[model samples]
Target: MNYAIAYVVYNPTVEQIERINEISFGHPVYVYDNSETISELPYNKDIVLVRNGRNDGIAVGLNILLETASGDGRSHIITMDQDSLIDDHFIKKLISLAGVDDREIIVAPMHHTGDITYDKDLVGKSSQKLYVLTTMTSGNLLNVQFAIDVGKFEEKYFIDYVDHEFCLRANRKGYKVVISKDLKMEHSLGHSEQKFSLLSLEFVPTFHAPVRRIYMTRNRSDVWRKYFAIYPRWVLRDFMRFNKELLGIVVFEDNKLIKVYSIVAGFYLFIMNRWGKAELRYLVNGAKK
Candidate 1:
């Protein structure tokens, strides 16, 4: 139950730093900063802060934190986003649920952010836990050994879909991804707005920049291709979800043409087997728009 807390931060806010100090009372907290400039951390002996001069993406930062935690003889590491808020008993609840399933390699808490929620069916089904394909990175308790065996998070995915890629890899390795309905946390996904059609309502996510859209589109395609045969149902579900998001961007969001172009460019890059940071033209054009 003595797990280390790890989070990758990029230009984090003061409240985030304070929350990290608060939740990491008796555990060692590793802070991997991907900001362009280093900032001062709270004066806590249990908190280990590492500064990367530039943004290396969440996967690389998380892997670094995992390596550091492993070297410190930690068996489990709880990975979270910088802005997420956890309950005071979050770790204790997660540890309890972890003991119920020996095959569980990653235990995720129910995430609530605005109107967005993960695992809606499992929300009040506290007595009935379910095996899921994937969950978000924040508020997920990862088994250190299982992570290492699965080769850690994929660095090629700069940000978007990094967690999904890890979860899919975990599933392929015969590791169970469990959802704890009883445990919940407050987390934010993106700046979303509600848009209404004649018969339905959709939340348009316009918060992410064009660069992030490129990553989301590209990484999603790569992940789908990798696991489509083994997880056809899940892949199909995601395909529909991707189309819905595209519709939202096209219909409800501003700078619609640029985002559509970025999405198309992302798919094109994926078809060409390209990865890593997007081209400068994409970023430049997006910025101009």
Candidate 2:
């Protein structure tokens, strides 16, 4: 069975990608470069670089790769972030564990080497029978068919919770998202930093994005709206729990506009039945200006 390692990048350091290529030598590297133009990627033939006309978000970029992987007849598509150090044995382990009939989405463990101390409870435990939710696309090996089936990461989400949303959808479809405790990788989280006013929100060593404060703020409501349509009370309870925590995080600590924008987005998501569309329109306007 063929497998491809795919990455989505925007104005990322060429050296870092090159280093990843060095680690995963002899495999086909598919990179969707969403920057202004596809800059020079590291390798030659094995590397396929798809350039978007402008800077699209990571979710859209990964969807491009998901399309490629599904069509190419590859059994597994390893989705990774540009700014991560993948384990040398990641591909080998995933390929070994992958069962065509098993219906599993694999997520590998990630360690943060930055300021936050490692917490076993947070990143260590699995949910129900499923794998623990760690970071994003960095350490994930997904069945290409599963991705294609679930519509390949909601582009409406743009970036934030795209992975979580994908995982949630996969679980709803009866696919078990499992984490391999053995495979180890380290991530330089929030490599995509944004400047809000003069004070830039420094990179947190996890999935935190200020610009994606829009996506993060809005898309979870999409999760609630869409998912709760099927499982009502349970998803509603979960939504309240998640939004309450998210409210504190954004309102108390984040940038004023981003915070207010999140509030507006989240409120509309709950009341207007728009879920994520309202925020998408807001982003479209922001992109225009």
Candidate 3:
């Protein structure tokens, strides 16, 4: 399958650049840099870099990649984050798995470092393919035409839940999200911390700053509101996940009061249908209150 490899970078390290170049060996690569100022990259014929003057967030950058792939007549596109590491044949593996089913619009590899387990009951022991509720953008091979058909990533989401929203949209359109349990790649979720709560026992949550917490909460709520009616079981499961996360933030994280405030503010924005980046000054000033 002739496919394009793309990475959305934001002030990436030399190690990340080198790793991407290595993994993307023979395929054409599109690098969308969302840094404040463009940085020069080492010359490589297989690599094409585009620098957005300012950070337009992940959703926008991904759309740019999809456009490039579609315009070049590529059938599929593998999207990756700057820090994600994959083998040279990662795309080939995903493509092979995708060949089993025509409805499989997205095929993702399992993460080596993050949550690697999928619901066993939902997948069963007989199958290597696990139909999941959602899959992250990184390390996933996307059918370009199907992705565009599902309306691409939600730009309003800006940063968080971009992948989840896309997967849910695809599912609604009868496209399957299949994960190859055998295929795994090195990827990191975020700066996570292990926290022990007296009430809930043990928990490890990805530690996000107050501002990022706002985006996470807001986007999550937005997605929940949109899909809860259609996918009640999945939505309820996600609701439980959110509550657990909120409890962890309240009981275990620092700046508890402000983080709680951000969560509330995020809900408020979601209820009002407000999207995009929240004003930092307002959050800071409100924190003083």
Candidate 4:
């Protein structure tokens, strides 16, 4: 199977992309830049850069990478984010776990932040378990043929639920989502981890920026509406997890009021069928006149 590396970079520096240089050997790489100002990459790399010239969101970038690479006769894509770092061994391990029948269309490495966690020693074992609810985009081997049949990604999702929505679609289509049992990767969630305690129990909430909160809330609403009938138990558990995060936000995070209001705005936007990038307000930013 011919494979290629597809990355979505936004406001990336050379140092960020430099991490992938080693593992990206032998396979072609498609870099979809969503930065307002594209940064120049180092010379002497087998990279094809496609600048979207604006922040079109992750889904759009992945869609472009998949289609562009598919046109180049690539059968599979190992999706990645500019910030996530993995070695050549990581890619080999993930691709080795693909189902013999190719029904496991989305094969991913296990991250601590995923639905389950494990010890470090389990970092390369493939389990027969399949069809997981979700997996992070980075370190995933997406079958290009399956993705094409699903009409690519849901670009209107912009960012959040892009991978999960696709995973759900794949499951519905008789394809499976597989994960390696012991292959561990440090995939982070939120801006940073915020730890707190309530009712004598400690909790850690994934703290996201206000803008991301809007996407999460809006797309999460859409996911529940669309998939609740098919995934009621998963929806209920996800609902509880979300509310718990909100409780942690109210108790421990900074900018709680603004983030909470962003959630409300996100829900309203969903009601209006508003999809794509959205701004909470013209708050302070790093813009220069």
Candidate 5:
């Protein structure tokens, strides 16, 4: 299957530009950059930038990249985030994973959030063959037609839980979503705190900003409602993890009042069947911050 490299960026920085440059391949790198102001990204032959001067959402940018690449006759696309760093070896592994039994799969690397330091004893589990219920958007070598068949992205999500919803839908249809146990990628989840470093792996708590907490809570609730019956293990595990983060915010993090309120507003919106682009300036009670 023919493959292409693509990533989406918003308000990219110099370091991010350098990171994107590191992933360049034989093909022209496709970029869906929705930087708020027109960015200073190069308009060279090696890069194809799709700067529409809007922050519609991550989902819109990703779908545009996927459709554009597929329309250009590519069989697979390795969608990545601008902040993610990769090398020749990582690209080769993704290419190889795409050739692993053509039975519709979205192969992703083991995401190592930049903050946690894994112990040496955790090395052998790299080959554990992890077939997860969902994987993140970054570090994925997604099959083009398979994604389109799964009904493209759920644009209503806009940002959070988009990948989870897509992966769950595909999993229900007997399609595979495998995270590469051997390959590791430098990915940032949130403000991470090392929880533990043993038990064959590690755990890190991601403390997101209050605004992000709202999107995550809302989208998580929406996706949970959509797929809880088909994937209770995933739903239950993730719910506990989310509550853990919430508890952390209440006890440790700042902006306690607003963050907790954001979660409540998010859940309230979900119950009220309201969706798309969350209002960022006020609470559910119409009080401005």
Candidate 6:
């Protein structure tokens, strides 16, 4: 059976699309452009591009495609970033891992130029464990029914940890979320956190951007309140670990005020039902100092 690809492309230049078109063959591609306005796509009858009037974050953009294809039953939808280059065996592996469930969600493996590995050790035991299965929607595939059942990606996340949030939701619904160790696509690491590395590893330092720190810390609290209430220790442990890291200032820029603000704001948002945007501004001023 042919799987219709619901590919999300945001602010893609012509060159990026050409690279994507070259690699993606033997599938009906639905391209959703999340730019302020849509650009003219190069010819490909099988490819369909949709435009958003404004720049919605990746999570919201994906929700649009999910809503559009909710009932139409199109095998599985493969989420991707515009910069990703698909390996030749990509689709075949996806179909293979899809298994017997026509409504199954199959996630693709993403490879970067440097070392990148999913913490398989955390599979069933850690707070990181969403579900034990095949992939994550960050650049993974999803069954239509499963996607709809989870009510699609939460648009409230905007960006950052949205993938983690989706996986958490899928896990709650007993959907299997696994990592495909065999199939791999190349990804560019850290379009944002090039400067802040603690151990020379590619992962971003939590304190790289004051804005990102605010979002990450705040949204994570939201995740705990909404989903992990049963596992209260998880958030507490993470909070302690983060404080240690902040004191060390190992990987990220050492911004004590910003770090404290992140934690406090995250907590405040949880208890007060507010976003802590004002706190973010205050932290921004402190960061400037």
lDDT of 4 by residue, 147-226 (tens): 88877889998999888788777777877777765577787787555456799856676767877778888998898889
TM per candidate comes to 0.90, 0.71, 0.90, 0.89, 0.86, 0.72
Worst 10 residues of 3 by lDDT: 116-125
Misplaced by over 4 Å in model 6 are 23-25, 37-46, 100-136, 186-209, 231-289
- CA lDDT scores, all candidates in order: 0.78, 0.62, 0.78, 0.75, 0.74, 0.59
Better of 1 and 2 by TM-score: 1
Instruction: Kindly list the per-residue Cα lDDT of model 6 for residues 160-223, writing each as its tens digit.
Output: 6677667666766666665566666666543334433345533344344555555566677677
Instruction: Report clash pairs, candidate 1.
Output: none
User: What lDDT, from 0 to 1, does candidate 3 have?
Assistant: 0.78
> How much does candidate 1 score in TM-score?
0.90
By summed lDDT, which 10 consecutive residues of candidate 6 come out lowest? 125-134
Report residue 156 deviation for candidate 5 (angstroms).
0.6
lDDT of 5 by residue, 65-172 (tens): 889988889888888887787777788877787656555468888777653233311212235446666778887999888888888888887788998898888877
- Candidate 3 C-alpha RMSD relative to the actual structure: 2.8
- Per-residue lDDT of model 1, residues 155-241, tens digit only: 988889999889888888988888776777876666654445623765646566777788899999999999999888778878987
